[model samples]
Target: MPQPPIPVAVLTGFLGAGKTTLLNFLLKDPFLADAAVIINEFGDVGIDHLLVERSDENVVEMASGCLCCTIRGDLIDTMHDLLARRGRGEIKAFNRIIIETTGLADPAPVLHAVMSDPGLLATCRLEGVITVVDAFNGMATLDAHAEAVKQVAVADRIVLTKVDLLEGREGEDMLFAIIARLRKLNPAARLLTTHRNEATAERLFTMGLFDPTKKTPDVQNWLAAEAYATGEKRGRRHAHHGHHHHDHHHDVSRHDEHIRSFSFTEANAISPQGLELFLELLRSYHGANMLRMKGIVKLADDPSSPVVLHGVQHVFHPPVRLAAWPDADHRTRLVFIVKDIEKPMIEGLFKAFTDQISGGADAFTDTTLSLNR
Candidate 1:
């Protein structure tokens, strides 16, 4: 028997970019009827899943702080489990997978995972990456959030949403400037506009990586188009990498914590239980301060395919699996942008998540190893 094909598409943009709204519209269509939806939110209270109306069996939402940062391992695991169930006749065959990133997320790492994983690449094809931009506050967000800028820069398709909500001359010009900036960031991406997110599923799916005629996304070309290609030309520049360069006193007075970001990656595959525990720990510590976390995770049990995770303040979306590997190298990569969290702390916690700490290392020792259901 032939293996079922899986098409993965990422929906990403800055906070309040109407990503959820667009998703709501997309999922309601008949075309998306059987697609498995994964929502990664970064908040203590995961309400987005509640907001999204879908067939319960087909949707999974991660309630951890950020899916991309904390639950990428979980994402891959979930996808594998989904496939196993499909093999067992547990659920209807899902031909497509849609991953929605947290608003304040950078899509590069997610794309890297999908385009680089080996197991995922064989069974699944990358359809395309769709970025939704809020016509109302997009310009201001682009200037403020580095993640938003990267989201626009790496999109295969840019969808302008909520244009009808904009009012007055300032709003109109802001919309135009937002589009102009997008053109500079990504010249080849197909552009689409939605006044109220009134777009057909066919139009949204057009940018997918798997052209029925051309089976796979050219891995080399896709990675090259993004910043990772010109890693040298881009420089070792991070939005929050140079904390020492900023005037701490002035920044505090001005409440510059609003503009914050961080990135981290690990060399080993994380245990599914370890990933969940790490997310719980993050929520217990930095839930309110976390803005976004997105990453690709390699699971110790399943190295062939990497899982994709996304999150927004306190709310985690679900993790999605790619069919086969995108490339040969397999390292768990995650990028996080937090409001006021320190980089060292983030790194320390990540290590703690994957490290084999002694059971007696802490006062409370309850790491039985369970995952997000």
Candidate 2:
């Protein structure tokens, strides 16, 4: 029998945009009482989970820096575990799943994970993506942060949060102006306003990617056009190759030295133990230089089902196993966007590990994965 699809919702916004506040509100909603909540935050120390007021069992925290980064692997693992427990009747049956991402997260990868993961796709569907904007600081945030723009551009629904804080004459002007900006970035997403009313959740989650009845995502506007534009501006960033070249001769800083993107792939499928070792070395040698690293890896034993990996800085989340490949391209596609780090260094470290694994070395002999310990 086909398993029921899991509906996952990604909640994103700029820093201090009331994402946590909105999440807290959703948790208390009687209608959404049984929803599983996953919180992914940026920074070395994660406290957003603490800010969430929910019972311990239902609220899962992925503290590997950012949802779009280091802990992405962990997100998939957590979801799988949640599904297993729910299947076993160990937890309350949930009709929905909510993911609250850090201010700095890029929603593209998260969305990709939901859409591409065969396991998730078979049993789960993307409900919708909701982006919250701080009415008071919305303009400034959009102007100052690329991440903020990405968040708004990819949203299936936009929530104008903290309107009460902007109630005066000036506040009203800001609200209209921000709405105009969001409409331009994401023309398809339905706009909603939030306050103490708690109406945003209902509006935002009304749509889903795969409707059992409709057989298509009700929210059909392609947010990827915006992502493609940004990608063009970022040039053609290859996951294993590192920097994107703009025409002829170029002299760019290495991955660890400045902000850059790097790509790499393993010829043979990677072992689970090998992945664990690679993550540990990442924390030890290049943790501080990392911004975000995401990949769909080919597992040695489980080659049919690729293992999804995400990491931010030093923290590595557990791996997420997909049920099948999303497309024909099966090579592990790992994209690393880093600051103050070199691509060669990261690639070299991964190569060294593969060498050791081939030589019959175990985790104890893996010297690089020792940083976190």
Candidate 3:
């Protein structure tokens, strides 16, 4: 019998951000007693896995160059082996999985593997991304490292470590400053302030509907359509991130440093044909610019039902139409995190497709999307 897809949550943070510490803490929980852990350390000497206290059998370590680069093929093979063993009942049955990426690694490549691999996609589904930030070093790291910025921008949740080190009113003020910067960078991710070893697995794995315990994921939580909506009103850019890049020269890798995230909402229903054409055009022309695209859309074919959309780069998961809207708000909303995409270009594409809106919408800033061919 085919099993239900298992949810896999990623644990990523900049170096010295307490990612391993958090993992060590979560593993202590009775809730994660059945969880399978895959640790990827980006060094020749992969000792992080050894430091983690686990029963040996369920924990996996990939200590090669990095999951983002050299060891990708091995990572996929490892997934297959784990699934095969689980099916044979050769190991304990884990209800979920947690993948810990090295501090220096970019998560996009791992995410792309999960999204694009048909074999893995069949058995596993992405629950969410949990990024740990070194409270003491996060600001400096972000300023100095592109990987750190991308880590924060792409996460569903952000966890800060070493808050215990900051002291007095000075510490309080500095903490606020760090959080302010974080919100500006990725407004959608939930920011939590907890002492080390205190966050339960429950709080960390809240990746929308994928939880299964809940009938439907809080759509607002995953998409944060309102945050992007606010950014548009105030004038801002798009931000979103993981996974190993399939190709360095591919358009997706070109402008990763300047990635931004924002969203759009349409009151009028969009024609299905128009939506399809718009997406195709966006993927064909500016797919490289798009890091992640997610939305709850009101389609002309099914005005009462809203469609769910999610994609990385040019690859999109099949659209899912809900029986009814989760709330009274029946408007169409799309949240985008892209490297160099502009709101005007997407708005123009939508306008060209359907009579959804009569006029083009405004962008926080103007950008010309060079549509070659």
lDDT of 2 by residue, 341-361 (tens): 656667655665556445545
Candidate of highest lDDT: 3
Q: Per-residue CA lDDT of candidate 3, range 1-373, in tens? A: 7666788888898988988777766666667766777776434443344333333443442222111112344677767777777788766577787778888988777777676788887888788889999887777788778788878878888998889888998788668757856776677888875585446678888665456566665677788877766655433333222123111121333233476678877787878876787788778887766777888888898899888887777877667788889877888878887776677677656654445444333311121233442
TM-score of each: 0.51, 0.52, 0.79
- Stretches of model 2 off by over 4 angstroms after superposition: 41-73, 196-198, 211-373
Candidate 3 Cα deviation (angstroms), residue 29: 1.1
Alpha carbon deviation, residue 103, candidate 1 (Å): 1.7
Error of 1 at 146 (Å): 1.2
Model 1: lDDT equals 0.60
The model with the greater lDDT, 1 or 2, is 2
What is candidate 1's lDDT per residue for 248-284, written digit by digit as tens?
A: 2221233233434445567767778777877777777
Which candidate, 2 or 3, would have the higher TM-score against the true structure? 3
